[model samples]
Target: MLRGAYLILAGTVIALPLTPEGLADGPWWPAPAVTGTSSGERYHAVEPRLADIIERREKAWKAAAAQDYDRLQHRSARLNRLLDSAIGVLVEGEATRARRQIRDLEDDLRTQTGELARLRTALVNAPASGCADSGGSLVQDVKCALMPDARTSLQADIRAVERRVAELRAERTRLLSDLTGSLQALGIALPASDLEALLVLVSADRLIDTYAAYRSLAQVNAALIRAAEAADGDIEVLKRYYGFHVVLVEICLHLHEAFLEEIEGKWLPRLAVLRSEAEAAGQQARRLLAREDAPELRARLSANVDANGLSIQAADLYAEHLRDQARTATERWAGLYRRHQVALNTYRTVALQGDVLSVMRQSNRGFAELVRLELPPLRDFESTALRDAVAELSERLRLSKL
Candidate 1:
């Protein structure tokens, strides 16, 4: 029942719909990617982030294969330090300076624009934020970057983002509630369980990238305050949040590779067992049905096997679908590196993470019909001998998830 992507978060299974179609309902902003050149050209340059991605990919995948998910996630924060140092060494100083030149110029323009707006507001009560509203590609980015009091504007923007995130949570809760209600209506009657909470929190930190999208703005503000050698509480706050974003980016990049092994080493095997058991049950039911002459008995036996059989197929398809999702995300990542690689987007790619979550959220609607189908009560089965055994098997499959 997946429309997008999903994952096993700290042993908790989550349904992530990160699909293009789902993005229509969300905000999507992507950083522009630059193309590469031949020998010492654009695309060929060594990117520290790319190298770190390879390293983290290798290490993280090893851990995930061993089923150490908690450790895998906790250690991601350390990679931020490792990555920063790596950039200082792997990437050329001149290239970085050159890249920042354009970014700096944009910052300057925004600063001047904000200043003019401030003057206008002082002379004539033109809306204090009106100038900021007209500031950049994204209004909040500009406001947080240059307009008004740094602390006030930044905090307000942060609050606004928090509100949006809250709304997303509410919407998700309702979606899950509706899903359960729909399932009950369809006769599955899913039990109230912890999986619903696990599923809801699956995308909890999704908006970290959105905060990082304000990276330039926040950084510029922090840098100015630092230059003045003045104390700013928001300075530490901004640093902590930005640092957190870096950790997440590193983790996500590695996950694009490591999580695939998680699927192979853990998830697929569970599904294989389910499918195998279901297949056997189908065989047994078929044999029993063939020997029975009552039409009613025949229908119940056939329906149980057929319904449960479809659940197994749906689960299997979802498992394979997750593998494909990780592979696709990896391919997109390969675009960023130098080897065999296409030159890809700037660091601002992190800002566009909401869309990535949207992509993960996409999945086949059929998965909506419980991947492990809740078979009708076993008492309805014709044969008394195999009914208990088959019922137990059905329950086991029903509880299984990727």
Candidate 2:
């Protein structure tokens, strides 16, 4: 019946494309494909905003370089403040974001200082060919004559801003990961699997380290998030999920290891009980057939009656109905055996999840060993540093092994 149901479902699905008006004639069960929905769009939109801000910042910086000393001072101060705001805003309240912004700012500041130094040098080396409109003061004439130097310096400053803008653009490539981490830390509500989201974030925030792949971090976060979500936001959720998943995994492994146990412990014994009745039924039916000896009775015995004394010849004929008048225990048991086979498929699906965890656990152990090797020697390793590195991994291991 189940096979027939699946065949019907399959036929319906295959016929969908052939129906007039596309999906109009299809069954109501198939969900319509909604193409425009995408959660990642929001993240992509934010990237352009960051890029624009960086661009405007660079423009203002160039305009500042061309103005007088007083103007340059004021404009530079404003640029600094704008950069500070950009760091805070772009980070969206993440410590790692803050750190990255700080690095960018430091580079910008360094470039600014270099430009300032170059401008000062140009002013000092002003040519004897004085300013065309200067009245009397030598300094005034020199300033006027070196006006082009100031303009050159301003252009260079503009280029520096452009470079900063480029850096900001590169930064966005990893912004999604940083944002996800920050959101997770801040307890922001986002609709998705936490593990899936964290993996996306980790992939976005990938490091340059060759030994460590972004996937490793993603796996760790996925396990952590799954544990937390499974526990429904409880601190102990991690502990319980790990425990339950591990136990489930162990049970599956044991089952696989001793598959014969099912036959030895249950199936064969049940079959014995079923077989005894079938054998007795066969004897009775044979005796009945022998005594009758009529052609009709002999034909009935061969077609409808089994050698095992039962009226039904084929064992499967008793699967659907069994009147109280007849004893076809063995045939009934055969039905139970077939049903058990069908039920075991569900068990195997859950068992596969446990197998996934086992594989991940082994991989994690190997990676953790590599991380240990990469850490500083004992003299360089501070207690706090060592403690922090292992804290989360140790917690995970404890939970998984439970």
Candidate 3:
């Protein structure tokens, strides 16, 4: 009876057709209506500019969506061929794989270098004499005297690690040189140093960095298949989906850029001034403590100095914490933007030739849903007091949609 019931439930689910509600259930639900508040009111003030941006993005997306699916398919195929050729050149003679190994070895070398430095410092600071017996056991005093010997052992370990690190660096450098030569032979102009190039790319934008680090040609091929499948073989739908994500990415990027501008232009400078002020206050307190001889007056001045120092320290720490928080928020949004881009691009490629409905029912369902979902962080950021103008603009955009 239990087996029969389970079979019946499975049959029911299988019989149910995919609907908008089903798709919405996964991730792409419509944005919630923005509620009114003091913050929201302030956001409304900049609604016109935000509306203009959204309208312009929507128009561009509509135009792109109108392209022929067949043409897109051809373009996707060409891109894939080019990408595979590049990967072929990279993996020739196992050069690509070697580069990856070299990267790992370089990381190990960095860790070992830091360890060696620390060990050297410990050796330099090792006590010259044994610990004095201050109501301690004799065994403890003997162990304390062995500190210098322990330091010597650490120094030896450091030397061994240093040698290993040097060997790894040499191997990595040689592999990198070989890889560079191979790519150049293929008419691909890659940076002389793969690691340094990766660092520069990653620093510019985390999302682009992920795409650039696809690891293998096969992964890139799979990604294109997934993208085409997501759009259900419809060029128009794929274009709209791509445009929507582009808008989201733009908004997220703009928000982060604006926040960074405020931080660098205002908050950071203010923090620096505060830090300097705190240092000055500390120096003043130390001098006062040294020079002042009056009992009651000295006591009052010392108390004032301590209080001032504590306040400044607290303020500096709080500012630093805010800066860290902003950075983390920006990184989170950047990562999400990249994921959206990947999903859209994959849909664009797959829409050219795949079984749209079949693929959608399988792997592409979640991808479709994700494209429509409003980013919570972005929504919350829009509602903040600091972004009153932006919030106002966003609210206008929402109302215009209604």
Candidate 4:
């Protein structure tokens, strides 16, 4: 559904070829000052009103930049603390902790497994029930007693036990996987005999596979942590990257709101006026055509009326297209802003809790990948105008270390 919506929006953009001036005439265009040319040569082309807003907000921008940097520093400090805690967990008998956890999970699994077996046995032995009528006169009340639905009850009980067993088994698998990975990460390998005893209920091949997968995941986790730590060390870089991203999101949001306001306040009113004019012109043209007498003059009048009608139709189409564009752009910007906000909030929370590993997990793989790929040099994101602006701003901030 989302893909189809985006395709439709892309088609709209491709189909409509409005001029920059036309777009700017309404609130559809982004603030010129915010998207000023890179060489600083085209700054004069910016609208006076937008330029004034940018100039007035210069101090605010600097303050925001500083605040962003401070926030980055705070996050870095928190991450450092988290890293220390993670290292502590890794160093302080992680294997022993994993073994204990695995043992507990195994015990729970055993209990659940036994419960499942008992439930299944009871289900098989449960009595079937049937309703029967005792022979009686047609007018007399029949004394019929229905047996309890023991089969249904037993089946329900079996299902409940099965679900519990499945949950316990899954938990046990997770615990074993974690323990295996932690031990492998620490370069500790249990002997085959020990593994067999520890995972007595599990199959040999499955244990081997789990051990291998755990080792691979442990390596990945270690590499991600190392990268995160390295990035944390360069607090200025992180600030610049994140600050630029935030600034872009802010600009997009501002532009979206401005476009919506323009649609409501300016465009809609213009459309309404155009609609009224078109209706009035159509009525006038119809009356004139009805009274026309001269051939050449009538033809000229008819052509003029047709041209007017066509102009109105074109105007209506253009206005509708603009409306569609505005709606699509608003949704796109909102979605982008939401994704960035979620990433930012999650980072802050997880960093505070010193759970960088949690952030690196598959559950947060998207965010982790973004951090790894985006929080680097500005040169990588020079494709689009907005990205180029972000790259330039990031470089400038990094140079000033502000």
Candidate 5:
């Protein structure tokens, strides 16, 4: 009964709004302290910023129902745009392969041409002096003449070389034509030079860089034409499936925005207070160390100074971490926002004016992927653990794999 009463008293003490200076017992600075308001509540109290995020997330959960999902058709269109982005990457890859083969063909053609030239040189010079043409001795010339099929053999070899060269040239031509047609079907044109550069990037497997190089030109003038020609069911499926995900993504964006705001406003401030306290404590300790005569007091002050310095260093690192998280989340939000605007604008365009999900728009860098940055020191809605929807959204969709 006495323990219970003490717990209630502790809870009441903790219930008051507290500050870093007010909480003289310093553990509460970084992680806060347990509210011992009652035996039932002998655990750490949630920070206001964190509590606000939880409240916002719960509200979003209550509001965003699957059936109540707004803009399914718009989401579907976004899905198609993402699909086109992925297909564009694949089409770029195919062009890369085609160009590589062309280069190989060009090399083969050069080799065969050189061989043909050598054979022709040999044929013309053969009958005149036989082995003598090649600086052979008189005895060798005699042996060369003894070989009656030498001229015929050379002619046959020339014919074989001619045939192989023709086949390679034909194959190269067909590949070029088919590659061009496929690209045209997807409303793209790979310039020979750009194609070469793209091929090199592809050889290096630079996915993000290739996206930068390729840009917004990859669209679907006639996607079905290409799809039918290539048997790309997977690409079609992405267009069909991920449209549903955009609804959830919008909801998660709200959660993420609240998360970022709390970090910027409160969580960061709390960290600042902790760091300031450490620095102030250290400075005071250091000054005392300079004046103190007692050996034990000096030792204690020196340790305090060291501890405070470490605390300041830790605060700087945490500050940097918070800023990075904010920047990353901001970029992601911007990308998605830009993409949605573009998707909406598509509705006013010629193609999508009448048909919503009939086609995809030309996307900027936003087409790459949607990646989310994490906010540290989470409580309650640790999205990854609780089958949270945001964790799923945070994943980078490998457009190339799609």
Candidate 6:
């Protein structure tokens, strides 16, 4: 009976309005204690700012849905800070419950922020015309203006998020549970509860940042296109489908270009640098090719081939594949050779005062000596390959002509 009375008394004390500073022992009273006249008045006072934060968060979320990544990022950052400030002032008891709610909002914000950072990084580093969407231009894209059925599907996604968010807000303890559940349904494994604490502090607007939503939109657009293609009846729907397809293709092409740049700039060059060590390895290859035809050379080539465990096709395609690889290498090397030639010419003509002897000397530098020692066979290999590709490509062309 005494324990029950104490529980009732505790509840009653928690329900009362917070007095001025020193009365409540903190800057703000907890949600559980926000019942009496003063607390209600205080809640009403701050409610408008909280509501504004909510509005900003929603706008950011919508902008992200529309692929307005820039606006989404800006608004998301603003919302997060505001939410943090609002949640900071509450008293401990009911405050803990409010904090739990705040944690949910922050987690969404942090996730969105991470997503925003990824999108921005992609845009910044993306090849060509850079920014995917500037000042809502991407919103003008056909994919954003989906047909009625597609729009209906998107609305369903929005409603699902809204419903989930509402359920979390209804009971503070369910916030993390709701998020974990949603992620699981999406086939995403969330971090452990302790790790999730960091995410919980993120601002409201940031909730829209790391955009799983755009990817979702793209998926929906693709599905709608498939559906329309199956029907093949509605002209209007077909038009929308084609428009969306064009946008998808354009974005895909840009992504491909970015990929190509990475290969060209980073990966392909490493291959060249490795192969440069063998650039003049052609004399050695010729000897091997000749030996393939010669009894002694054939013996050596066959023995070496066996020792290396290389396929027999290496010999059969030896000249052909070597030619192909060499041609590609030379086409690339030509760019470097051209730059070097220009530098040599500039030194010879401009610095050496047009002396042909000086130009020859410039051509045969210490670098040539290094090449002589290190890669004497490379140039020879390249020359042999070039001769072969010309013959092969010419044969193909001649056959085509025939």
User: All models: lDDT?
Assistant: 0.37, 0.31, 0.40, 0.40, 0.40, 0.33
Model 6 lDDT per residue over 239-294, tens place: 33333322222222222222233334433343334333333354455467663666
Two-way lDDT contest, 4 vs 6, winner: 4
Residue pairs in candidate 4 whose N, alpha carbon or C atoms collide under 3 angstroms:
82-354
Candidate 1 weakest lDDT stretch, 10 residues: 19-28
Off by over 4 Å in 4: 1-22, 25-244, 350-402
lDDT over C-alpha atoms for residue 59 of model 3: 39
Query: Candidate 4, residues 151-218: lDDT per residue as tens digits?
Result: 66667677887888788777766766676665554343554334423233112222232222222223
After superposition of all CA atoms, the RMSD between model 3 and the true structure is 21.6
TM-score of each: 0.31, 0.20, 0.33, 0.33, 0.31, 0.21
What's the C-alpha lDDT at position 29 in model 6? 19
**What is residue 379's positional error in candidate 3, in angstroms?**
24
Q: Write the per-residue lDDT of candidate 5 for residues 264-308, one digit (tens) a residue.
A: 655466666666777789889988999999999999998888767
TM-score of 6: 0.21
In model 5, the Cα lDDT at residue 170 comes to 87
What would the per-residue lDDT of candidate 2 be over residues 182-234, giving only the tens digit for each residue? Answer: 44443333333432222211111111110111111122223433333545434
Q: Give the per-residue lDDT of model 1 (tens digit) for 153-225.
A: 5445556545555554555455556545533432235454532321221111121121122222222222322
Q: Give candidate 1's error at residue 344 in angstroms.
A: 16
Q: Judged by lDDT relative to the true structure, which candidate is superior, 5 or 6?
A: 5
Model 2 ranges with Cα > 4 A deviation: 1-95, 127-402
